[model samples]
Target: MMAMTFSPKFRRVSGAASGESTVRRMALVAGGAAILALGAVGGYRLVAQVEGDRGIAPLANSEDIQVNGIKVDVTAKTGAEARLEGWKLAQKEAWKKLGGPDMPVEAIDAMVSSVVIGQEQVGPRRYIATLGVIFNKARAGQYVGAGGATIRSAPMLVLPVLYSGGVQQVFEVRGPWQRAWAEFQASQSPIDYVRPVGAGGESLILTAGQASRRSRLWWRNVLNQFDAASVLIPYARLERQWPGGPIHGTFTARYGPDNTFLGTFEMDAGSEQELAGMLDKAVQRMDGLYRDALAAGELRPDPTLTTSGQVLDRAFAELRTKLMPKGGAPIEALPQEIVLPSSTPSPVSTAPAETVSVQFASPDAAAVDAALAAVRGVPGVRGAATMSLAVGGTSVMRVTVEGGSERLASALRGQGWKVTSGGGALRITR
Candidate 1:
């Protein structure tokens, strides 16, 4: 009789240890929920307008990738040794795909941000896996001879609208197109992408149709709510060659307040199995196209949308001065204006009410109504209006109030809502 010894490593290990002392293993595949949850912890968040909640901020420089069909075998005294070697081989291949060529093995290991296991098969002494790898941008770029710094453009909101199955939608339901954008790491590109998760009412307003809206005034208001300078509408029309067949996607890159057509590209997925990866690739290409347009000065933000508020303020000041006299007849009848005993109120000019966009998770119709009512019921809330509504997700409401977000959040807290403040927006989830 022969005895096999198996010992588990305390640090990091996955899968069941079999009778053999040797082990083969695999890692780095994540679903949309898992990826989004990761972002919730450390990713930069921007409150969505209609779909208010935490949104994944652009990675600024990171990349998400999958290294598939990894099959490697190593002869070692132990199965753990063989498994570790297989992972090393897979990481090396992924690094090469990321543009790191001829780099030292030790250096490549340091650039790996994370690894997730998608598929793994363990034989007596063999291992196979489909791994997902996220590379640290700064380190990977250095090894690949790519630029290290990101030249970010003015912030532009991303509305990834998909046309599929004879319907057009943006966050109305779960779609691969929107998921691809959410999972994308756009740090290396010149364009600063402001992507919303579209949890609620935001999706209702920031839709495919919004790309065609030419009113700078409307754009200005929308941009103000999201703190975006302009908008990018990356439209994808998916055409299935046949049922359960290849998917051909026609993508167009449009930008600016007017949604000017920049360019279009076509990509295809061999089958439904390839659709997700194909969409991810298309996003990267779309980002590259945007970067190219920016380099050529073709993607400039509309000044009308960005500076229009200041222009309006100045015009209003002029109008007020002309329509309303600041001085009372210059005291023409008196030699000297008698000063009152009261302290001279230094021109008591009223500050304009700050518009605060409040986002809350509404899991049902009742919750939505409750949130809207709670917002309106808050003291100092001048008015509240729904900007976007997702019946069972996050919703964004614009609140005109006397004080800023602090005041609104304080009030919501009183109502037993968990409020988190970020980037001048409030997210209330209960």
Candidate 2:
């Protein structure tokens, strides 16, 4: 706003300032457009990389009890007749492997679910094949006796980690180790394996690096997604003599968020053609290691990963303390129905009331309600609420009672609940 004589030098300076300002604005606009274009390209590449053909869908019906390596060779008047005879022979042999008593081929056939042909050659009057027989657990359980009735381990998420070419991966790519685990039939095993198909976000989440993370919070979140109580890591490291020559594999069985090692073994394959079979055998051996660990009480779910009863106990204690009167005295249980004079204040009783955590098996919603109702029906139970609900597994509930946990356990026992008390919590069952 200066009113003065305009000099040429001053005018030229002013023109240069305006030009510089315009150039800066134009540069900013161009830079922003370039950034946007780069961002778009980056986003497209990310999407393509994640959703690309990098996943393998697991085979369906993995719960069936499978018996493999049953070889049959038979000759009949026709190939059809020979094939039928081979299937029947395979079933009979599979029954024997299952510890079943001697029975007619027709009886074994009744229990057979499906026949998987591994390799087959059918001629006009002959059939030779290596076969796998799948038996329906429900139909075969009676004949198999206690093998089908054994206690199964808690749901353990299976992360098949492959270390090949100096790289570790789980669900990052479709590898032989993952395929072997996917093809494994788990119904006959006592380990409840929860195998995730390496698709979508699963590939991103269940990478090899995740196995090394010991953070309980992160593990809890991951396990919750699959409804698993713990994690099982089957580690495989492969070494090849040549591109198409003999290969050796080192397999280790690990469990829990801490990646505790259970057992390890090594296997060899004659060539790439035998790699799948080697992996399959390695998977079976790994499963046996896990089973042994389960028997030794080494495969239990990590307590920190599940709902912490101590947390609920502490929260209940805090609430109780806040509601207490000025004096540090135990709160009394009020009667279900009370009548008092309008002008009289309610009296405070000096009886002790403690919060008890109760854990029980909740196989379904009805079982949850039943357990709650049963616990609430107990004599000293002033209130009961579900702290954690894990249907088809153990669930936890918080019970505020007029007495301590032992008294609550005794009361529950008296009510026909099989009660086990420890660690300030009570486990009850029917």
Candidate 3:
């Protein structure tokens, strides 16, 4: 290191110079010094740039990666850790969160795999896993799209969103088996709910009037932590052979709530006490169901068994069927979206009485425009609008002829529009 010195050429003249002149000279000196400092900095920067250019060299070699694949070094020891066994537990939770109502735990586990931890070493070591999470996507999509529309839909709740295939790739791509296991454990269904989504608990644990409000409370509690949308449950039919003999049972299950069937479960002596307890549980189950579902002056069951005779004494024919047809239950994979409130009406009429939806083949804008014009000319046809065009979905143009909707459809048919009339209206062929 060396010391630098500066001569006081712009020195304070003190009493010799007037105060104003002295201040002005000091400022000029300071400004000059600043300019010199800036010049020195600029020169240093230029030199640094030149050195950097000279020092720059070709990059070193490294492992290669392919799409949907990445490079990683794996050690045999990390793959066989006992903690990894717990990973399945985490998978179960993730599955439960994913499964929603009464989805089979084993099915979920079987579908979603917790692959072993792997590692890669270039200079440092890392962990990784390839987890496969299989689910019923179509149903899931519906549930995701249609969650939270009705009072019954309160059970539909979705949790645990795995955006990737569990193998997150970054910094040598890794996922910890232990951490994965912890996450699996962290995920849980509404275990506290008597009947979780899809009424899973009732099918597994309760019998008789198990479809009561009390039982549903258990489901409500379990699903309480979850946002209402994530849960997706489906209604199903079961041919159950209990101690009382075979009963063709049917119930609607909220996703992950309780009623998912995982193969067969034996009631043996193992679950007897619990089974007996269900007698009272059944009564408790309906605690608020009847009151909640009742209309003005409608007959309702009391949780305290006040209306047992009324419930049981009902005409045999009437007692059997309530919500759905006998031997015909709504069978669909879960995550069936609770249909959201839609201002946009479906072009295809599902309502049996109000309107008819007819589609016209329109390959392009011109074709669609022509179809619209043709529809306008038809008698009784009030209005025609382009439902969808060019887009892959419902590319057919829809013309909703308004005058006595049914008559309009008939009139369109006479105009040679290929049409199928149903759902309270007609679908003009596209």
lDDT of 1 by residue, 1-430 (tens): 2233435552234434442223432112224446677677544443333443423333343453334344455545456766677778878878777666787778778777777665666556666666666666556655664555656787789998899999998876778888889877665567888888676667667877887888877886677566677889999999998999999999999888667888999988999988977897899889888999988888877755644144455565566545443565333433444432223223322446678988988888788778877886775555566779888778898887756788788988999999998978899988
TM match of model 2 to true structure: 0.67
Q: Report lDDT (CA) for all predictions.
A: 0.71, 0.81, 0.35
In terms of TM-score, which candidate is stronger, 1 or 2?
2
Rate residue 37 of model 3 by lDDT.
Answer: 85
Q: Return the top candidate by lDDT.
A: 2
All candidates: CA RMSD (Å): 23.9, 13.3, 25.3
Score candidate 3 by TM-score against the native. Answer: 0.23
Per-prediction TM-score: 0.54, 0.67, 0.23
Model 3 lDDT on a 0 to 1 scale: 0.35
List model 3 lDDT by residue over 301-402, tens digit each.
121121112233344324333423456544342234632222332233223322345555555656655565566566434334454566333454444343
Name the better of 2 and 3 by TM-score. 2
Candidate 3 weakest ten by summed lDDT: 61-70
| TM-score for candidate 1 | 0.54
lDDT of 1 at 237: 98
